[model samples]
Target: MDSQQPKQPKVLWLNVIVFTVTFAVAAIGTPLWAWHHGFDLAQFIMLGVAFTFTGMSITAGYHRLWSHKAYEANSVLKVIFALGGAFAIQNSILHWASDHRIHHRHVDDNDVDPYSANRGFWYSHIGWMLRDYQRNRYADYTNCRDLQKDKIVMWQHKYYLPLVLLTNFGIPLVFGVLHGDIWGALILIGFTRLVLNHHTTFFINSLAHIWGKQPYTNKNSARDNGFLALLTFGEGYHNFHHIFENDYRNGIHWWQFDPTKWLIKAGSWVGLTTKLRITPEERIEKAKATMLLTRLKTRLSVSDENQRRIQLIQFEYDALLARMTDYYAMKKRFFDLKKRRLLKKYERADLLNQLQKMKSELQQQRKTWYSLAASYSY
Candidate 1:
């Protein structure tokens, strides 16, 4: 299967036709009825539940658990996400993760990145889905080998298109029929929810790259925006994600609106998942300091006064990094001894002191550096 790419489906026509009809019907049929009857509170309730459940399924299950291996979930969550992703009407988890991995690997490269943000916001957000610009449809498989190995991912991939049509239309139809509110259910949950979910997810690919601050790293197009993060279940912290993609948390800050992160944390509590890996605080601070240095350097090259300030910063920054390193290294050494079955009361006290010192040093550096950036107009 690695030797050849999957054939581009002639399903483009099918997609166009089906989407057109689906949208048209929901757009016309439901609203017309609603105009005569008016919107019901129950319909919104169903839409809310569907959107939240299915959205989390994609973020927590497909992106975090399956794609990034940030954590592991039990079969129950796996099945739930599989079904929710299907109901969400995004592609299968395998394909979504596959394409996402490729997007990361060749970001902004029009020829390789499946949804290259270089094509502009609208194109990246929605156009890529409407057309095929990349030659290797399966290019992302390289980064998603683990997902391909999963039985659920494989089954979801195999049954995606059928499942998409079925769940999107069927569930609403069944519920609407049962509730005697067919038009409202179809319009509210089926189409509106899909459009909203699709666009919201798409923003992470498009707007996220263009609209946020790069706090952790500036090496990539990824960014962090509070508004986008809110809309995307904490995925708006694109910069952090690009810098540390393997962490189960996207919005690691105290108030980042990352429901996905919370869900994973909740899962861990319930014993449904484990091995959640987060980048160390020291590492996070280091990246922030490096980016500050890089930005200062950029500004310094043009301003002599700023250059003097930056020169002063270079020496102080190096000293701080060394302090952090020594602190962390000693801490690691102490912990490793205990990890190797050599725990001692004395060692525990030593480890606590070392860890506290490292944390304090990092905090001090961040406070001073951010203060410097705030004052440096140049």
Candidate 2:
């Protein structure tokens, strides 16, 4: 078969029909009905609350906790996430994590990647789900063996249909009845909230790859965009997440809008989450430095500069990277020594002295590295 004209898998009529009808209801029905009979403040408020719960479930629970094992959540939290996942109307945790693992493992490969963004925006965003392009891929969820072992995950997968109906409809109906407006709640919270959640999550696979800066690595299409992160519950930091998949936080900085990371951290305080994985700060800085050096080299390659000048800059870049490597190595050793000191009954003065010396050396090395890096721009 021609590479461009690959065999089209069977169409998923259920998904096709559901997405179409819901989208129509959200787009046309919402405006028409609202215009005729405006929904009350309570219904709008319910939509916002429902959106937050379901969206965070996917980000903090499914994506970070289950899919990447970035952190461990207690059984109660897991059950809550399961219910939220069903309410969000995404597939079962097993299936969602399986496709995600494949996407990360074979990103940009149209043949294997369940939703290769390189195919096009629409295709990556929603087209992949519309057609059964990889029917067996979803069925063969061996990639999600770890998740399958999770009781909450397995239980949700086994009873996903009933749970979906219960959360999606039951919750809305209950809220509507309490608010004395079943139709209003269903339209606002049910249709509008679901449609918004679906599209925002889909943006990570589509727009995240297309727009934004690739500061960490350009090996794949993923890019980091703060704007997208705000919409997708901090998933907009796609480039960082792609490079540091196991890190519990996508938005590494404190100021980054990663509510999911905040939720996970908050859960830990109450014994609801544990073992949150985090990338070392030095490693993240090193990745950024390496990408900068790569960019500079590419620029020099296409420049009409003197050979001697280019060689000089290249030498400086290599030296800075070597210094950075040494600094991180020393820092690692210092941390290891500190860990040993804390764990062991006896604390040696000499060990503490050595750690302090290493820490000072690392600080000096970091200063030198930054100075050298700054010189390149001049």
Candidate 3:
């Protein structure tokens, strides 16, 4: 008898039609309409507004707030995100978060990961959605039990289809009525915005894995790409995200283009969000230092006169990590004392001085380590 072949999952014609129709309208219909009818400033503005709102909803609301629980959001804020997520047409929070949690847990596992990039770019990007590859697991939202407790998340899940219809059509129709350009609003704000949101978010799954540097880790295919960050509302820092999955901020530098982080931070000021989780600076620095030292060690191993160079590099690495440990330890103590409000004025001043001195010493050690690491890169 011949061995049985595994059955392929059937194609989801609804997903195919939705993806095909929206893309066709956005790419082909939009420009053709614009060439004859022309777009005004308001139409373009509506496009920009819709695009930003929906993208932020996905990055900040869906990925960070619901999926990772990186921070706590108030009921009102959660409601807005729920509505915006529906408008974005990326599925309900329960479904998206369930898939995302699985993706993180089994990232590159082709057989398990929902959008495993290891399967190839097209599959990770959009092909995963075009079929019933998940089978009965489509309704298996066990990973999202916490999100199920949130009234906003549950309401969205229960009424998701109607919510999708309401926001997707209602917003565009409202914009159309107000702007007195119904077709222009639908084409630009509705179809075009949807296409852009879908693909750019998909880039985080596909291109983010294929391109950019893996400064934090190489365990998975995820990489950090600045250009993708700009396109995806600051989600391009995928390497960091994979390792530090619960950190509310992806682009952890002040100069990085993480508007999503900024929006969440801004919300905290008005009490819209709280308990924003972050990876400690010590942990982040240690990761970078470890990766750099590994590369330096590899490069040095190839040199004929590497004994002394290797010894020096090892010495610097040890010293840097030691100083880092002490600095963060003292910094933590300083904060604890400050928070408790039990320190005498002079004692507080003494601790502050100690922290400053340790910080300066750590900075000097870091500079020496980096200088040494850079010299051997060639």
Candidate number of the best lDDT: 3
Model 2 backbone overlap count: 0
lDDT of 3 by residue, 1-378 (tens): 999998878999999999999999999999899899999998998899999999999999999999998999999988988999999999999999988998999999999999999999999999999999888775658887787778889899999999999989999999899889898888999999999999999999999999999898878999999999999999999999999999999999999999999999999999999999999999999988988888778777656579789889999999999999999999999999889998899999999999999999999999999999889899
**When superposed on Cα atoms, how far off is each prediction in RMSD?**
5.0, 3.1, 1.7
**How many Å off is the CA of 290 in candidate 2?**
0.6
Give the Å shift of residue 348 in candidate 3.
Answer: 2.3
lDDT value, residue 269 of candidate 2: 96
Better of 2 and 3 by TM-score: 3
Q: Across residues 1-378, which tens digit of lDDT does each residue of candidate 2 receive? A: 647876677899999999999999999999998999998788888898999999999999889998899999999999999999999999999988888988999999998998999899999999999987876566657788777778999999999999999999999999989989889889889999999999999999999999999999999999999999999899999999999999999999889999999999999999999999999877798798778767666655545564555576557556656665666676576568777666343454555565567667656755665575566554
lDDT of 3: 0.93
Steric clash pairs (candidate 1): none
Model 1 compared with the native: what TM-score?
Answer: 0.89
Q: Model 2 reaches what TM-score against the true structure? A: 0.90
If ranked by lDDT, best first, what sequence of candidates would result? Answer: 3, 2, 1
lDDT of each: 0.81, 0.87, 0.93
